[model samples]
Target chain A: MTAKLELRNVTKAYGKTTVIKNLSLLVEEGEFFVILGPSGTGKSTLLKLIVGIEQPTSGQVLIDGKDVTAMPPNRRNLAMVFQNYALYPNMNVFNNIAFPLKMHHSGNITQKVREVAEKLNISEILGKRVNQISGGQQQRVALARAMVRNPAMFLLDEPLSNLDARVRFSARSELKRLQQDLKQTFVFVTHDQKEAEALGDRVAVLNQGQFQQIAPYKELYEEPATAWVGDFVGDFPMNFVDGKGFRPEWANIGSGPYSIIIDSSESFGDIYYVFGRTESGEHIVLKSPKLLSIGSQLKFSVTRFKEFRDTPQSTVGNV
Target chain B: MVSEYNNPRNRKFYFIIAIIFVIVTLIPMYVLIIIAFAVPSQTVAAYYPPLFPSQFTLSNFIGAFSGYSSILQAAFIKSLITATIVGALAVALGFHASYGLSKMSNRMSALIISVLFFSTMIPSLTIAIPISVSFLKLGLYDSALGLALAQELVVLPMTVFMITGTLQSLPKQLELQARVDGAGFMQSLYTVILPLAKPGIFAAFLLSWMMSWDEFTFAVILSPVHPTLPILIYIDSTARGNILFASAFALLVTIPVIIITLVLSKFIKGNYLTSGVTG
Candidate 1:
């Protein structure tokens, strides 16, 4: 999959204070790309820029090779699900789903709504007002509302944050399946690394308004391009140790230059911080060792791992 | 932990307040209904302690409604027109202004809020004198149009105050979602913003209507030919011998205002405390 949507130097500023820096990203077609970051890291703002609720201070948004930088949200052909769900309270589930169709003036509005309602398992409550439905059903209606239009891109802003833990898990799986089935791009914004890892085809690690790295979920986890990305996308247990940034060949955990291996030079940022730890149950950290076997096509069935460090590492800008 | 004594004290306090409240409230209501229906007796000995009407008939309604097409009916019609005109104009302006204000920067938002507060603080009476002068000079004085326009200065700011609070409570995500759903800005406002803010709008409309209905100072000073109900009652009672019919005419205005308040009571959160006191 290649970029179906791209943001070129997108920035958003409020008067004197800039919220989203001159950032850029590419979301591949038919792929689930997550802009994962902590709160106020501009993940949501990036989604907003793509959707055109707010214009970039200076940037261009390209969709399928065409520049849609100045286009309104409707013109962008991107559907969004908000944290609040934003289902119209006055409209029933059926009408809410039918609204976009009616706006498009595409016929078969009823059949379309019914098809989506049935698919989303909300057909039973199609006649119920949004306020009268449960939170999960409201979310379903919101999703259905976005779905009925068949938008080119789906921009979700932590839509499951309000759900209970159990519901969140279920909605997550269903969402993944939906994306796979539709074969449409899904750009999700979330703080949870687990969510990004679980759902994303590629995860774009963002912090402080800039993207640290964008890679496939497993690659991002295993070989983070930057230390910030490593900390952000850490799922497998790996002890982060304290060490100064040094030349990759000369970087050491102890006395002399120790053997340090990386998948590629691209993962080697300007500085390399070495770390290592000892003992079976005791904590350990090292300048990450070469994650390779004698064979080039080796596969690891191992699922759990942890990281430990002897001393504290510097938490500098852009990690 | 709480004590049982707290409950007893609360109950005792409520009992005392309830007794005093009933007496104070019922006494005026009891007297107004009586005097409004009764003609003043020629003799001082005619003052009798009767809770029920000795002679109940529709004559009071007829007497209040029929003569010279009556002070009550004309005034009622006048206030109705003034309130409808002022309320609609004020609410429409206030509703959009608040939405515009909400989208502005904090400093600019502060400027708008300060303006709203400042306008409300300077009582209408302070400006009424100058406005009355200007209107008189412009040949706009002593007309219902003048009265209604003057009432707008009061009603507009109030409408904004109430509606702005309602709009502020609505999350910004709703609009963003609406935009993402393909609604244009105005479409989002009508389909999402207006419906969500309806409670506040209804409440503001009723309050503005009341302000226009009960606005006596301007109505009295401005509209000489077409007096609103309050002004009509004041003029009718003050003009020497015609004072005899004042109570009956006052009762007529009272009836309609009460009915409207009752019907729209669900939307008006603080109606009971402010109704008579404000007027």
Candidate 2:
């Protein structure tokens, strides 16, 4: 019931500037995947590429082993929910929902429109114009419009961002339930980490057009593949220590005056930095919340710390 | 200082201005209506001795409508047909052109739009000879269709630019949603762009039609044989020595347009002012 979507080292450039670098990720059949990032992080560009509204400068996009790199959005058989819920203003609710069926050479437009409207719980609004509807109802119409087409892949770019908070939460849950019930491949993009965590089966943490990490939400949040990913995935993202080290420091773990034991595998140095617990109840801000009695002084290695782009003065009571 | 709390003072100030404005504009209309009922000789001199007509009769209006052969009648019909057709065509043509212009890259489109506006300042005096000669060469001379076409050409750029401006201001998400919903080009335009641009379309058509109906120099130069209402009034005034007849004729020609504008005034917005007709 679900389709497979794969992006192989996709690159996008506009004139002299490139918005999306060589980026790749995959959404297996029936998986709800999300590309999560900050505002100008090329997340929407990736969604546009997949939806075929945009073409990659290099590499390819594939769905179910078929190449669709050069296809127009109309030929891609993928539906997208735009951020602003683009319903036809000239059309009433029924015609707006029926538009997809009409576009794709379907005969039973009425039946399909009715079905989608009923499923989305917007049947009552079928007679009304788009401007007359509420935001959440408009969102449902957009969703229904995208769904009515029976497309292979669904590309949603901040689909629920326009909704109020309570509506957003419910819409997300409903979207997830719908995706599961339909068992279709869904590639959703959002700047909100919580939305990604709640909706995506696999989350791709992107920053500055680069795929910093891609894994199931748990692994991406708990064990980030890159520093950027670590900083981006969590609720209050993983704090970073304003320091560095090499293998030389870690090789002589206890040899230094301030000895803190850390798993030195990822720390590309010989005792540059470490995470170890101390006598106090505080955990190392850099290190995981593991209780390691490294000594009285090296307690949690709680040193000069700040969040990403945080001011030093703010760390006073922030500790 | 609580200066804004003086409601009585504000009302008095506004009332005075309103009275002044009403008197300034309405006094002329009252004089004209009175002249419209006077004898031809009295129509001019006694028509406006600052109020009542010294000698009252409907002969001036009846004579204006009939004594001028069927020329005035033909001119009135010509102007009506031309204005209505021109307004409709200008608006219809504006829709597609504006859509394409608005959806294209913003910077390039903006430059193109600036150039279009710059061309609007082109003096009608300069273009008149060229337009007339071209129409003659193209075999569209002295025809109602030709007159309508000329009027459309005059109004098209502004209408198209206005509608395009409206379309640009519309949120892009609406177009995208229509596309995602499986609407093709026309469907998307009708459903999304068209509905959102109602105010612009209404304003553009009414304004363009008004311009076409009352335009004097263009109608005089291009289609003197098939003159519009404005040109006909000018001809009558020049042939005879009655500015009163000209004024009454001018007022007659202006009534339909005024009715249209007044009725549509409520809905005519920036885009409607610049784009196409409602239908």
Candidate 3:
């Protein structure tokens, strides 16, 4: 099957600043692809380039195998949910959601709006102004607006970043479920690795306008293609020690080559994270099922280690 | 003393300042009212003006309204028509121009906006003669439409600058979202931008109308024959020395502005006018 969205050698620059440098991506149909990156990494710019909100300095953006690089945003047939949930503050929830349908001159717009609102579970607040709703509800209204059009692909730019932590956690699962049920191409961009892991079928770790690695969360965690990717994709991330990388969970109290003095330990339910310093003064964390007290010296061994070349890109994958 | 004044507990100081402000503003209007109703005998009897009307006579108002009723009526209609047209054109042009300027690069937009602000600083009298001569040659000398377009020269710069601040304050993503949600450029402008900018636009409209309604140089030079309220009032008071009639007309002219300000003051923010100029 052809990819729903494709960017070929897209290079975006403004005067002296090059935001995205020679980037390319292909999001297959019915896949939830997340672009995970730190801020100013050109993740949002990539979405803009795809949606035709901003033209790439050099690129050919393809939608369903058709070149739409020269086309305007409306003709591209893609819906974007912005980072700030850019719902029309002047319009009520109903009009805000129904705006796309009205623009296309869709028949039975009210009925269609009702259906989308029902799906998003925002039917009750349809008459309230956008500002009158909570941030989470405003987010749903934005989603409903995008979904009402039934576009070929969805370009979401950090749609859940504004929600509270409790809401964000639930919204992540809800978003994943929605994508699973709809099975449309979704290209979600966010800086949060946890969000990307939760919602992405495959997450691309982007940094400084380049894709460091793109793979499933498990693969990205277990087999990072670059040292930067290894350090970026996990909760505790990966700690670099003596020209090698390893996850905290991979090291535990056992017979090993290195010994460390435990600085402290914290417990979260079934697991304990023991933070310590190695003999060479490298900070390391060991995740263990058993707890260890502070100031206790323990020997630890890594089951596996990711060896990386000494470069800014930190090319990885040698075990 | 300064400390005492600055203290939050100083209710007496605030009351004194309030009384001073009310007196300062109301005194002129009170005097105008007293003179407007002064009978012919009272005017000739005293060399100095009376604090109160010695005798309130309806004849001054009757003479003012009936003698120059047609001229007043014509002036009233013309001023209303001119202000409304100027207000509408200024707002429409300002909205589009501000939106366009908002999309420009920072250096370019700032340069252009600086030029606009600079143009407003040049006195209207400097260009009044040239504009009047050109209007005469163009056969636009004494028409309300021509007057309105001329008034736009004064009003558009301020309106555009103010509306630009408002447009800058709005998030760019709203328009981008509108475009991705299937709106073309024009569609996004009207549906998303214009509606979102309603308060600022209305404020711009009110300011334009106020400017046009009170505009003297353009009205006096451009339409000397078809006088607007300000022109007629000026001529009546200064040239003809009809203080009573002019006071009544001046009072009449102020009513709409006062009403508009009172009704729409919340939308007309001082910060909205100057917020994004430097930023």
Candidate 4:
């Protein structure tokens, strides 16, 4: 199937510094594509390129197979939810959601606004101003405003970053379900690995204006193409021993070759991590279901380890 | 621990300052009231301190109001028309200029703002003769519209400066979001930017109206044929030489400005801009 959005060798530079270097990707229709990275990794810049807010210095942005690199943001027919929600402070919930429809001069605006508001479960607070509602409701209003246009794709720039932790978890699931129900292309950007692992159909790890790896979360974690990708995509960062990758779960207590003295153990509810050092004084963590006493000795075996070459640091900018 | 203001010594200091402030500000109004109610005999008979209205007669107010009833009515209408036009024009033109200035580089914005500031600093008296000559040549003299246009030039600089501060405070993301939601430039400015800028515009309108309402030099020079409230007040005070009449007219002129300031002050508090923007 043809992709809904595609970037061809896009590059964005500011004077002497290049923020996004030669990068390209395709987001298929109905795919929940995520660009995961730490702050200032050119993730938001990439979204701006697609939405036509920031022009790429040299690249082509195609939406539905049309080159839209030169198009203005309003003409791009794509909606973006900013990190701060960016709701019009002067407008109430109903007017805020109906803003897009009024822009297009779409017929039956009241009906269309009501329909979107109902779907977003903000029907009761339609009369309340955006400031009167909670942050979660404001998020829904922003989403409803973007949805009233029914654009071809949605670009969310760290949409849930402003919410509390509990709200963020529930909002993540709601966003995923909403994407599934609408079957529209969704490109989400975030720095949290849990969000990328839980929400993306295919997660792309970006660093310093370069796409390190793009694949499903499982493959990116279990079979990372580079050492950087392996370090970036796990809840607990993957351990590197002698330039080789070993997942915490792959280490087991046995009579194989490696022997280690237990240093400490930390528990995170159901799972515990046992910190240990090999005989040669290499630090390693063994994932265990039960707690282990500190300062104990044990022989451990690694089921397997993945060998990865380090992607040279010279190619990407200093950011 | 006790707050500084709650201490006895500091409380005494505040009491003294409050008494001084009240005396300084209220003395003028008290004198004006006494003069308005004083009888003609008090001034002509003897130059005593007419601090109290010993003989309260409605004749001074009646005489002052009746003498200039026709001129006062005409001047009141002319001033209203001029002030309203000046306020609207200042807001419409000044808002757009301020928004444009807010987006410029800091050095450029500062340079342009300073230029506008200096333009306002040039006293209106210096330009009054030139403006009067130009207005007479252009056939714009003796017209309320001409007076309003003249006042607009004076009020616009301050209006634009105040509006620039307000626009700078508002986040630019709201406009960007409007653009991404499919609004054109003019549409976004009208729908998104102006509504959020209501406080600044309110303040600009208030300042513009107040400035034009009490303007004296331009009203005297360029508008000799079409006198405004200030010109009539000038005629009543200097030519007629009736303190009671002048006091009554001054009070009349102050009422509307006070009413407008009270009503629009609610909108100019600067609290609404950040209400729904930040959590």
- Most lDDT-accurate candidate: 4
- Compute each candidate's TM-score over C-alphas: 0.80, 0.80, 0.91, 0.91
TM-scores computed on chain B for all candidates: 0.77, 0.80, 0.83, 0.89
What's the TM-score of candidate 4 when only chain A is evaluated?
0.93
| Stretches of candidate 3 exceeding 4 Å from the true structure | A1-3, A310-319, B1-23, B38-55, B262-279
lDDT of each residue in A95-194, candidate 2, tens digit only: 8777778778888888888888889999999999777778889889888888887988788888888888999999999999999989998989998878
DockQ for every model, please: 0.25, 0.26, 0.44, 0.66
Q: Candidate 1 at A149: error in angstroms?
A: 1.0
Distance from true location, Cα of B240 in model 3, Å: 2.6
Better of 2 and 3 by TM-score: 3
Q: lDDT tens string, model 2, B1-279?
A: 557547888979988999999999997787667667665455565434544446677656766767764887788889888888888998899877888898799897877777766645777667777888999999887777777876675688889888887778777766665555566667777866787888888878887888888876668778987777888788778877666667668668768877988888877643322111111
What is candidate 3's lDDT per residue for A76-125, written digit by digit as tens? 87889888888777678999898999888999999999999899899899
The DockQ-derived docking category for candidate 2 is acceptable
Best by DockQ: 4
lDDT of 4 at B266: 90
